[model samples]
Target: MLDFHMVYTCGYWSGSPECGLDDAQQQKLNLVCRNLNLKPGQTVLDILSFAKFAAENAGAKVVGITISKEQAALVRDLCKGLNAEIRFEDYRDTLGEFDHIVSLGMFEHVGPKNYRIYMERISGLLTNGGLFLLHIIGAT
Candidate 1:
């Protein structure tokens, strides 16, 4: 289960200390889009659905994938009227090159055994000069 506001990942609080949870989450999304230099009509492969709506709002074509059908449905509904597609699929099964790839809070599920393979797959999916942002919880 996630928070009541549907924010499942950590927030980026450095930008606005006085912001509430929702604002902080939105700030994090904006920061990622800005750092990635996403442009209008660019294709973005979002491993998690968190950035789908935000990327679409920034005028990018977002393709968000999640292993859970429920999550996919929810994202699809939330992203209505935007250039976004949410799918219930695994990242390894994803195809097509993207101008940007973003994975937040999903790497931990890949585990150490599949880390290299996951990186290779992500690399292969990215187009030349494409940017990738991986935000994960590292080991202690």
Candidate 2:
């Protein structure tokens, strides 16, 4: 059940019509890592995202925050022996600056009332020249 990089969220299916779920997930992960330019020993905030992948593949030290206990546990297990920490809490309560931040399909829960605050916090948590990758689904 944990195969295919343990992808539990949306995948990037924009490439290769013949690609399967694993390929799509790989593509999405690769795309994000490339965009963030993940590097060795860099600090990253994943907003409860693909931290294990980044920590393992890029040698990044990642902190992933989520409101879900299940997700936190799963990520903690997946990131075992890596430079990754999964926190179960509100993102607003998370502290510290990061070299890069990435969130995939999480902005939908930021409720309008807290949208501005959330964005502000994200900005505040970013170090100078840090990159942020926000991947969301468009409702049409």
Candidate 3:
């Protein structure tokens, strides 16, 4: 049930055949993952995960957490192929560490008041020299 909804709403059910997302969206996502040059066995944490697209394309284990439990379950079910784990918690509440961090479309939620805190948490979670990717939308 949860998986179905995620596959549909998280831009997966569009039936585009390229991971179910638009070409531009897929290209942007693939570009970022490829630029990272992730190792095959790396553990990649996807902050505020949507359909697990980025994580899946990276060929790494995925740890996805979302503020909404439903969202987490959806991602968990959607990422069945990849080594994926889903948790329900505010990003601030998550404490586990990872090899790499890829956060997409989540910076807007941090706001100016919480940006530093968010960065610090992300820093804390990453192992030394581990890469971090922060993808956000710029204001008009």
Q: Indicate which candidate wins on TM-score.
A: 2
User: How does each model score on lDDT?
Assistant: 0.81, 0.85, 0.68
Candidate 2 residues 65-133, lDDT tens each?
Answer: 999999899889989999998999788899999999988778877867988998899999999999988
TM-score of 3: 0.78
Q: Which runs of model 3 end up more than 4 angstroms from their true locations?
A: 1-21
lDDT of 3 at 50: 31
Error of 2 at 64 (Å): 0.9
Candidates arranged by TM-score, highest first: 2, 1, 3
TM-score versus the correct structure, for each prediction: 0.90, 0.91, 0.78
Clashes of each: 0, 0, 0
Better structure of 1 and 2 per lDDT:
2
> Which is better, 1 or 3, measured by TM-score?
1
Taking all chains together, the TM-score of candidate 1 against the true structure is 0.90
RMSD of each: 2.0, 2.1, 5.2
Error of 1 at 91 (Å): 0.7
Q: After superposition, how far is residue 102 of candidate 2 from its true place, in Å?
A: 0.7
Cα lDDT tens digits for candidate 3, 28-94: 5555567677766687777754337655665677777788777777667677776778888777888
